[model samples]
Target: VWHKCVDIVTAGLKRVAEIGTMMPDPHGYRRYCFTPLVAWTADLPEQLMIACVSKSASPVTEATHKQFGDSHSHSSRTGDLTLQRIEQVARGTHPWNNLSRFQREAKTIQLSGVHLPFWRNWPFADPSIFLLPEILHTCHKFFFDHVLSWCRELLEDDLDARFKCHHKRVAVRHFAGGVSHIKQMTGREHRDIQRTIVPMIAGCVPPRFLRAIRAIISFIYQAQSPIHTDTSVKEMESSLQEFHAHKDAIIEANARKTRSAGTKNDFHIPKLELFHSFAAAIRNNSGLIQYTADVSERLLITHCKRPFERTNKNKD
Candidate 1:
């Protein structure tokens, strides 16, 4: 019988091999496998209350109406990126208008309105901390990066455009459907086009963690568990070497894009790229990167930039 370690290490060692290794399920919504570490979620900002006093705009308490009064800026270390963007998008408006609880006199004009649904619930867009265990578990369950790579292919191909367009159409349909429908047909309704386009997108392996339990189980099943030998150790070494190679390949691939597209990535796409790969391998082109992507004092400050007056009268 083959050794357990040898089996898994063998699978991992063959990075280019098609071993049907079950990696993590990116589609999982209920399982809280890996938790974001730095998230320290609870300590971050939750709600901001903008007291709308109609007494000719009297400044409220310092705790309430401070520098970030209208602007609900949270600790970046703990702030959710997506939430912050929504706050930004809501723009210079009252974020806490909906959750305000103030007792006003009969003459005070007081009512509440929320600029967006949640004050700052989307964290994926910001710097997120994911549990290594979860990533590992996922890698094992999904069997290397095959599933993830497949998803990325779809995204770069039919899935990304189709999903984006479909979502856009759906959104427009809710308020202005007829206009978008007239523009083009939805992606799903046309199978021939989708099949033709899928092959063109890039592909990658799903993320990995060598010792993921599910992966361990499958590898063990393929061989003899609770067993180890010199061969197993050698196999593991080979796997690690291949791991480094694949990592370099992925970096090189993404790096090419950066060089080609002069615009620097304001946010990291590694995780999203991993998501793409996972979705693709499962042959499921439909996937979403549930994360945030905007948070910049520079950008925000720039948005507040005003025009400088030029005085060149006689020259022209």
Candidate 2:
């Protein structure tokens, strides 16, 4: 199924390439000569990865294969590399070479001719290039889930008890007890924090904490900007460096508070390393990375769900 899909897509691309070559523009500008490139973007979802790599063993698929399919599946095995091992193996370095062993092996996928890995070959550009760090998922995990959540924990009680609006004959209970006890904020709640709480607490929290928030938000906003250039990439790198420095300082100061507060949880934030990976993705192919964010997918899913809800098919 995977190879078939690849063949169909590649065949279409080949025809397009041929037509592009044959067609001539009046101004001698051949727009069709420009080949199309594509990348598949998704969070590291287990089942999706299994399907992409053809490791799933569902009975329906097995049954369909048994009756009519070729006896051999495409090179379906990687000696010892499993999906779960990728993050550990990659070590936040060259995502293509370090993450997928098979992708590294099939360094270049030709649009024409035989595929080295018969089963799963990329039809467009190299799979390594196609794999991108989704900003919506990755940034949210780092900035909101990890960084903001930790900040909330450390500041919530204090903010609730002490921080007040400027015109403070009245107590501002916007965050009465700080956000520490609350679970990770929802997307809407996170926005509310940015809109309402960020300015409110700017003077209250350490300058470094505010700087970190601003830095992360700046990177995210810059990434979403329509403008693309080397300068944007450099800007993101600079933002990341600023974020890292401020993050380390905040963590160091919080270390003592965590120790004294009798909390068993460490101040460590998960997937902070992915910022480097995300930046690398941008460095490798900024144009492609721009399109890989999860914003479109989330919107598409919401659009698709509405019809199901209207038909009462989505009722729980």
- Tens digit of lDDT per residue, candidate 2, span 1-316? 4545556757656556435444467987655464444445665442124233332221112211122122221232231222223323344444444435434432222111112222133234433344465655656545556556545555665554443333334433355444555665555455445444456556767788778767777776666555577888779768867776676546554622343454432333223433444444566666533665456666776887666767858466
Cα displacement (Å) at residue 251, model 2: 3.2
| Every candidate's lDDT | 0.27, 0.48
lDDT of 1: 0.27
| Per-prediction TM-score to the true structure, in the order listed | 0.19, 0.54
Q: Candidate 1, residue 194: CA error in Å?
A: 23
Candidate 2: list runs displaced more than 4 Å: 1-36, 46-120, 159-192, 195-198, 253-271, 287-295, 312-316
lDDT of 2: 0.48
Error of 1 at 300 (Å): 44
**CA shift of 190, model 2, Å:** 3.5
